[model samples]
Target: MTTVAARKALWKIPEAMELLSISRTVIYEQIRAGRLRTVKCGRTRLVPDGAIAEYVALLEREAGR
Candidate 1:
């Protein structure tokens, strides 16, 4: 049995892009830059919810600085 939060913890690339209103290119760029973290499951790349939140927090901190 999978809890809702457990299922939501991992997001596909397209899902993450949709959630963040960003393009595929932007997502890849973030991943490449190490600002966003991802994991590989078979051939699929998955982004964690925590990574997304951390990225947002980093941006917010940068904006504040």
Candidate 2:
């Protein structure tokens, strides 16, 4: 099994999109809605590993309700 350590702590927008199987619009929407957190460095936006996991967990919790 792959470990978390094997993954990057920070992911680019396209990488996040691919990993989440989501579109750029949806990502931006989520960010706008304060569902997902991100970091900005220069001209790049980065998603932290913890934020992705938190978003997924939030989805799961919402689905259970």
Candidate 3:
């Protein structure tokens, strides 16, 4: 049987930055501005895949306006 690669449900801050092609400061700024959503697990922050998608959609909507 062939197997497909599994997608990540959660991403770390650095990973999200890389995925979004943004800098660390910008990522944190987005989170602080409520443009991006993140969850705190212990001392680590995690971004859900859905949040990233939502952020992109938000940008697209803004661009379309």
**How high is the CA lDDT of each candidate model?**
0.92, 0.94, 0.97
Residue pairs clashing in model 3 are none
In model 3, which runs have C-alpha deviations exceeding 4 angstroms? 1-3
lDDT per residue for candidate 1 within 1-65, as digits (tens), equals 87674349889999999988899999999999999999999999999989989988988999999
In TM-score terms, candidate 1 sits at 0.85
Candidate structures ordered by TM-score, highest first? 3, 2, 1
Arranged by lDDT with the best first, the candidates are: 3, 2, 1
Q: What is the Cα-based lDDT of residue 48 in candidate 1?
A: 94
Q: Which stretches of candidate 2 lie over 4 Å from their true place?
A: 1-5
Query: Which has the greatest TM-score?
Result: 3
Model 3: how far residue 60 lies from native, Å? 0.5
Question: lDDT value for candidate 1?
Answer: 0.92
Q: Candidates' TM-scores?
A: 0.85, 0.89, 0.91
Error of 3 at 7 (Å): 0.9
Candidate 1 regions exceeding 4 Å error are: 1-7
Give a tens-digit lDDT track for model 2, residues 1-65.
87675889999989999989899999999999999999999999999999999999999999999
